[model samples]
Target: MSTEATQPYQRIVQDVRQKIRSGLFTAGAKLPSTRELAETYAVAPGTVQRALTELRTAGLIYSHQGLGSFVTDTASETVGGRTDDWMPDAVRTLQQQVRDLTARIERIEKGGD
Candidate 1:
């Protein structure tokens, strides 16, 4: 077996992905900040940002401007998974309501009842 070195940012992406898949960082769990992740992984913050970008593009995590990143449901992107204990019930409820309303509106617009 050849020992090949993966790119630093890709390594971050893989590790985080594995963690999420293994349920260590289950859906809606807040990921560590870029700075913290950089320190933990001993990589530059920019590298962490790149990994985060990849995750975001893949729909694995979502971020709010000041709130930071949280994992999304990898199994079904349309429905949000369970959130962290610290996440407010109202926020989760509101998110679900929005999704439901949007889906209803879409169906209506398509004349699909």
Candidate 2:
């Protein structure tokens, strides 16, 4: 699919992803309804639905038929049926932060401060 066709949905995905990572949307938090999200983002409901689907696919969130979507607790959820080495965006960002912190600690230990 063309990138342009998916841009709106991708924007929503990034927004929701950042919120989840920053703890603005806590685990099991009910996501704003798709209609609400669409209005907020000024996109069509279908675009918001697509964004939610992407988040679900990445294991960042989930949805029940009658209930709305919710943030997934990475500690408890096995995302996308893979357990060992799947690194989604939020996890990757966290991993990078850890690596940076470790480097900083090493430098301090070496008196590189």
Candidate 3:
């Protein structure tokens, strides 16, 4: 997959993760709505959702049914911790590769490739 093709959601994930790690987005901070994030990043809502889903999976954030997503209380701990609780580098790398491949496949299916 081209780097450009995989950039949008991944960029959002990286930026949000950085903010969490830097304490710019403190624990329990409410993230913007999906629509707001989409507008901020100039991407589709689905892309923002994908980035938020990755953050949630990494234990950095959580979402309520209607209240919207917020940084998890343990988010800073998770970001700073290097324990078994945190995902290993290998796992993260593989996950990125999987996302790239999935995007490539989707583009091909849509005849965008």
Stretches of candidate 1 above 4 Å error? 1-4, 75-113
Q: What's each prediction's TM-score?
A: 0.63, 0.62, 0.67
Best-to-worst order by lDDT is 3, 2, 1
| Maximum-TM-score candidate | 3
- Alpha-carbon runs more than 4 Å astray in model 3: 1-6, 81-113
- Model 2 Cα lDDT, one tens digit per residue, 66-101: 667877666134432445355677775564445445
Q: Each candidate's lDDT (Cα)?
A: 0.69, 0.71, 0.76
Give lDDT tens digits, candidate 3, residues 11-106: 898888779889999976889999999999999999999998788667677766566787866678767764334677668545545554564576
RMSD of 1: 12.5
Better structure of 1 and 3 per lDDT? 3
Candidate 2: segments with Cα more than 4 A from true spot: 1-6, 75-113
Report per-prediction Cα RMSD to one decimal: 12.5, 14.0, 12.9
Give the TM-score comparing model 2 with the true structure, all chains together.
0.62
